[model samples]
Target chain A: MRVLGVDPGLTRCGVGVVEGVAGRPLRMVGVGVVRTPADADVADRLVLIERGIEQWLDEHRPEYVAVERVFSQHNVRTVMGTAQASAVAMLCAARRGLPVALHTPSEVKAAVTGSGRADKAQVGAMVTRLLRLDAPPRPADAADALALAICHIWRAPATNRLQELAAAHRRTPTPVRIPKGTR
Target chain B: MRVLGVDPGLTRCGVGVVEGVAGRPLRMVGVGVVRTPADADVADRLVLIERGIEQWLDEHRPEYVAVERVFSQHNVRTVMGTAQASAVAMLCAARRGLPVALHTPSEVKAAVTGSGRADKAQVGAMVTRLLRLDAPPRPADAADALALAICHIWRAPATNRLQELAAAHRRTPTPVRIPKGTR
Candidate 1:
């Protein structure tokens, strides 16, 4: 399966596309970065992001999309902006009817670097080694996007289990089944 | 001075370019919207935003950029993404040596609607009325961007005062003259 991984941000976003299934060596399809100016207005930046995604989708057409879940601490301003950015990504995925998976930072780090707390540099290094790249992906965002794809592959089985459980729950009979004449 | 206002988001971003000086009515030079699919990857979305901003800047060459200062809430996931989007905008503006300003949501709302608690629709309506638009800007995001520009104009005097105070604080006192043999 072709999987596209994204590191979403307002200013700069990193994207990596990989083609393969879980537990198998994935082939790199493409990698790139998108940047917005500090001076550009928010609306313009968002428009740029949308257009870029459209172009990437048109070019790669990946089957699944994986995005890093937003994580914020005490910075309220930062958190709010991040949320808006995340919404854009989710909206994009939903609009296309593509299944989207959100991975936590720790999960991505653990899957890629065998450590949940791995820093950006460490994650980049591991991604390079895993992908057998001649050089590390420029800009930490791109490498993180690749790691996110790797994380999705590692977590896919669990995701399936969760989905199955949800489905089973839905299939379970309601506690109060009424007769046809019942009010 | 030319000011670009942005209402940043993941799916749609509103951009407005206005020109005016202190005590002068701001004239709308241009306005447009950029949209992205909800299902596109985050990286691609950001790339689209960057390119869109670059295109607008190249075309319009605004001297200043103003964006809404995002405020975070309970949605950690969404906030992170917005922060990234804001960063992209800031970077874009900084690259061109264009001064950037951020206004709070309440400030923008109050400036546009005369009420800080106004909803998007209300704010949008007021923006249309204020700008003398034939219709409300499509997708709502555009209207919000225009409102942000209006806010910046309303608040510019206060910002100028702050700058003056800061400048005064930085002025060094004249060096004391030392008599040749007084000591």
Candidate 2:
């Protein structure tokens, strides 16, 4: 499946689109970053990011959107802007009725580099090799976004099976048993 | 001026539309909250919020939007969600070319009540009295939104003057000096 991965940030939002599924060679469809000035009004900056993401979505039309999830509630700084950008990305996907998946930083790292503790450079190098590109994508954020998409594509099959199993369990009601004197 | 105040929240975003100018009778054009389930998918929740805010804007046709500025990054738990909702509100305003204003919690409280540290109930009571409402608006968030609108109306004149001064300075050319013999 074609997937658009978002490494969301207020100042710089990275977007990468990849096409492939499990056990297939992934191809890079698109990659870019949206940058906004710190001096601009917050509303104006947000508008810029929103429009940029919308343009990317319209152009790529990914079947699924994989976003880097913000799982930490520990750090107060940078959370707000990051979350805002993440939400904007998600909104774009939702508007198009695309299935959205979220992967943690560690999950993406492990999926791409086979090590949860792999550094950014390692992940970037893995993304480059996996996509068969001569060079890694420009800007670390862009490379990270590509990694997120690759992670989602590789993990989707297992996730689908788990979801299917859960659905089956839900559909079959538990058998009721009669007590000694109960009808 | 007509102003829409947004109390941004992920689960319950409060929106209030008020019409009037400073030193005039402020009337409530509309008031409501957009709510989504806590268990809903993040993308779906954002889409719900985006649509709700858009509906409010379309229905009210407000000339300006006043959003509560997120100041503290102290609380990591809900800050992300709040900031995301705030961004959504700002995007709606920006899309319509409306001038957006941001007010801090303390500023809103100070504008509504005589003190910056006034409690929510105090702010609500003042909002009711200022708007000549029969009772305080339902939900604290809704009341806070009205207070935000009121704050913007009262503070806008000063903000406008600053903006004007800044714009005027930008328009005038800066002095350029010629070298000693070139003059």
Candidate 3:
């Protein structure tokens, strides 16, 4: 399965595409950052981001899109921007009818480095080794984006299995139990 | 001038259109709320908001769009949703080449009533009185949206004048003064 990962930010939204499934070697289809000028108005910046993301979507056409889920507990000043940017990314993916998944920072880190508390350098190193690239993707954001994609690819199988089980359970009728006084 | 005001929220996005200038009788062109299911996913909610805002813009053909500026200081649980919805509203307006203006809640209240700290009821009452409507707009959010449009219409004149002065200042050359011992 091919997946596009987005590490959303107003100033620099990182995007990367990874192709593979669980327990298999992955290939880096494409990776880059969508940069918006800091001096631009917020609305204009969002427009730029939308265009950039749309271009990426048109070029890569991944089956699933994974985005870093933002939490308000992060840096107070930047949390709002992150949330807004993530929303834009998700909206773009959803508009195209692509399934979108949100993974937390720790989840991405844990998937890549085998530790939830791994540092940026560790994530970068792991991505480089896993993708067999000469070097890690430039900018920590880019590495994080790749990590998100890898995480989604590795976790999807388990998630799908659990969903299937839930569906089966829902389809099964609940057995009726008669109360003692109900005749 | 015609302005479409948006009080954005994931579950209930309030939209209203007002036509008039400062110190004149304002007309309420339209007022309503675009609601999404509470259980809907975030990305879907944003799409709904974008569609709703676009419909309002197409119907009213407003010269300007006013959206409530979301701040991080709001209720923690809902602020993110509010921010995301506002982004979609702003994005839709910007994409259509309509000038988008963000008005803070305090600014809207101050423009409608005389106090920045005025409660929702006061602002709603003022919006009703100003629009000469028999009753205030329902759902408080709709009234708040109308108040936003009114605020923008009232403040645009002063803001334009200030912008003009700033532009003039930029156009003016700075006078050179020689320092002591420097020819």
Clashing pairs in 2: none
Per-prediction fnat = 0.17, 0.78, 0.67
* Stretches of model 3 off by over 4 angstroms after superposition: A162-183, B162-183
Q: Which digits, one per residue and each the tens of the lDDT, describe model 1 over residues B29-140?
A: 7888767677755656766776687788899998778876765653655555556566556657765767678888889998878889999999978877766777878777
Model 1, span A16-129: residue lDDT tens: 887766777777788887676766456566666766766777799978788878767645654554555555565566557677788988999999888899899999888888
Estimate, for each residue in A33-80, the C-alpha lDDT of model 3 and write its tens digit: 999998777898999999999999999999999999888987876888
On DockQ, the leading prediction is 3
Each candidate structure's TM-score, on Cα atoms with residue i matched to residue i, is 0.56, 0.89, 0.90
DockQ of structure 1: 0.11
Off by over 4 Å in 2: A71-77, A162-183, B72-75, B169-183
Write one digit per residue (lDDT tens) for candidate 3, span B1-183: 999999989999999999999999999999999999987668878888888888888888999899998888878869989988988988998998878889999999999998999999999999999999999999999999999999999999986687578769878999988899976
Poorest 10 consecutive residues by lDDT, candidate 3 chain B: B158-167
Question: For candidate 2, lDDT tens digit of each residue in A28-65?
Answer: 99998989887777788888998998898889989989
Q: What is the DockQ score, from 0 to 1, of model 2? A: 0.57
Q: Which one wins on lDDT?
A: 3
| lDDT comparing candidate 1 with the true structure | 0.75
**How would the docking of model 3 be graded?**
medium
lDDT of 1 at B41: 55
